[model samples]
Target: MSAPGLLRTERARLTALYGSLLLLAGGGLVALVYVLVGQGLYASVSGVVRTVSPAYRLPVPGETVDVGRSPEPARTMAPGETPTPEELKGYAFTQDLSDAVTDATRHRLLMYSLLALAVFAVLSIWLAWWMAGRVLRPVGVITETARRLSGENLHQRISLDAPPGELKELADTFDAMLGRMEHLVSAQRRFAANAAHELRTPLAVQRAAAEIGLAGEPSPQKVARIRERLIGVADSSEHLVESLLLLAVSQEGLEPGSTGPVDLAALAAAELAADPPHALTVVRTLAPLTVTGDRALLGHLVRNLLTNAVRHNRAGGRIVVETSSDGELAVSNTGPVIGPADVPRLLEPFRRRAERQHTAGEGAGLGLSIVAAIARAHGASLAAEANAEPEGGLTVRVRFPLPDGQGAVRGAPGSKIG
Candidate 1:
């Protein structure tokens, strides 16, 4: 059979293994004890028997007694007659009789010991099998629950009732993993629904613009307006498609040999200089921090952060871009007040505030989500929180692991401008 089949069939292998070990130990102990007790008891009993009868006496160990070789038969003691020492010496224990008793007693002892050991071994094996089953009961539950689960039934959990140990911990961890999978699956469903709606809206708009504007030899003015509208719709669709593809790539993870030392401070500074928000006051605290990751993705991360801040900000508001020597980057902007609870939803694809749902000229709602995906791909942590109300905005932070053999570097002085 295959290895997995062998393992399944021998689920009680631990029981048999331990039982065999105990049996071997018990056998060794039985042999040692039998030898000691048998030798000592036989010697003492034979000595006593020799004393009981004056006609016989204990002989030296291993000596053979030959009755036919005796000079004469044993003689009985007469009343009121004293036996000579020579007579007593002649009746000294015979080897044949001693050997006979020794063999019989040894055989009986061996027989009893073996029988008892056999019975104990059988009991031990049964007990071991029971204990093993009890110990592995949680595993059985986990397996059954897993077999019953799929993408459709991810709600099921293995609530194992085993004692607190490795098995219980494993079950709990498995349940936690299922919970995460369920959450991700639900989010994916929502994302698909939202993506379909978003993609469909522009197509519907373009179709209407074409059907109405191109009918019956339209005027140049109507043609230009319709053509412009079509181009804008097409551009929006292209942007949405591009964003989706980038998100996929980021989540798919950085390719091998695509990672190298990247100066995060320099990258952020370049993004800020490239597209300085005209209406917002920009402040920069660029530090010299080096990290390892895909530089293109890193650039996209910085650009998205800046664009998110600019798009979702009040006119003439402040935008603070900061980088630290400790491989950290943070961006904060002044915008509409956001609740603490709603801040986490911003990292999800196509998630937007109700107020922004009707806002125009705002790019597809994937900037922060793409940032999150890229951060995850680089093994960096990203967190966003609502700034205190009154002067409301959001602060998003990303922490990256430093490149190998690199140490913290001092940050440059803060610079403020638009």
Candidate 2:
């Protein structure tokens, strides 16, 4: 059977179980009452029979005695001829009526007990079914709502109206999960559209360069220029595709047992050294720091931060990279002043602040986003703040959890520059 059929069967079983239990208890009570009343009535009747022995006598075996009737013909006896007490004890006509009364009472009691039990059994079953339905009504509603849910109708919620209980908690949790799913889905759709747009721009450039430059057989100089343009566009497209792939992988998170302790300071120093600080004054306050994560991804994260700082900086600007033993790394650079509100958009894929200068080697704007994804994969926190310098720059900080769950040591890293 399907899930709903199984649930209905379970509900029916619960109803039957509860109803049977109640009916059995009631039947037991009725039976107990019947037995007790019969026993008490028998005892009382025996006592009365013993008390009135002289007035009433039971018939002997094999004696056909008529109750409440004299065996002899009705006749007036003389004073001397009156029956003695001893003779009356053996009187055949004086039959005991207590036995008959007790028997009749027991029969009536059994009949009433059976009748009441039958009536209450039916009543109890109905009550059980009603109670079961009341209790499982929330479950049914949740099932139906879940069944109707899809990507199209994920906006709908199981806003169950019930008192605080397990069922209500379950419903609330489900609603919370649905909300997260909807957000994730919307974000994914946006990411896809943005990526397509980013990819299309380069392709369009290559196509235009080809059509305009190579319409007919041209000079060697023109072909060389067109070649350079196509190569540049192809290179940028390749970089964007790689960035997208890396972002996707980082979101999936690192594989288990594929991580180790990496020195954050060492990684930062290496990235800065590898990339020339062209027309930039670089300052580093590197301290010994270690964190557990994927080393390659960590290296990429460091490289991205440095690249972002360099790309966004003005000519002859200063760049400061800092790392501490407490597992915090920060990169700050001098650039056009950015607003605090605009800082968050930089962490989104393909989002760039309008005030920033776009240089020839400008990135696909996924540097900070990839960094954020890698940080999340390593169970770290990332935050960006606009620097207070009049020549404006931005500072990005990342904090990773200690390997042994030690307390974090917080301290200011870089000094203000003129």
Q: Where does candidate 1 have its weakest 10-residue lDDT segment? A: 409-418
Task: Assess the local accuracy of residue 61 in candidate 2 as a C-alpha lDDT between 0 and 100.
Answer: 45
True-vs-predicted CA distance for residue 290, candidate 2, Å: 1.7
The residue-by-residue lDDT of candidate 1 on 1-418, one tens digit each, is: 8866655654568787868887988899899989898868767766665655534652333443332335665444445555456544555544455667788888888999999899989988997778788777888899899899888999989987777899999999999999999999999999999899889989998999988779889999999999988998888899899999999999999999999989989999888888779978888898888899999999999999889888888978989998887778889888889887788788899988543452357777889999999989998888777877676888788888776566643332221111
Instruction: Estimate, for each residue in 277-363, the C-alpha lDDT of model 2 and write its tens digit.
Output: 888999999988899999999999989888888888998999998887787888889998888788877888888886324345877
Instruction: Please report, as a residue range, the 10-residue window in candidate 2 with the lowest summed lDDT.
Output: 409-418
- lDDT (Cα, 0-100) at 132 in candidate 1: 80
Counting clashing residue pairs in each candidate, in order, gives 1, 0
Clashing pairs in 1: 57-93
TM-score of each: 0.83, 0.78
Pick the lDDT winner: 2
Model 1 lDDT vs. the true structure? Answer: 0.80
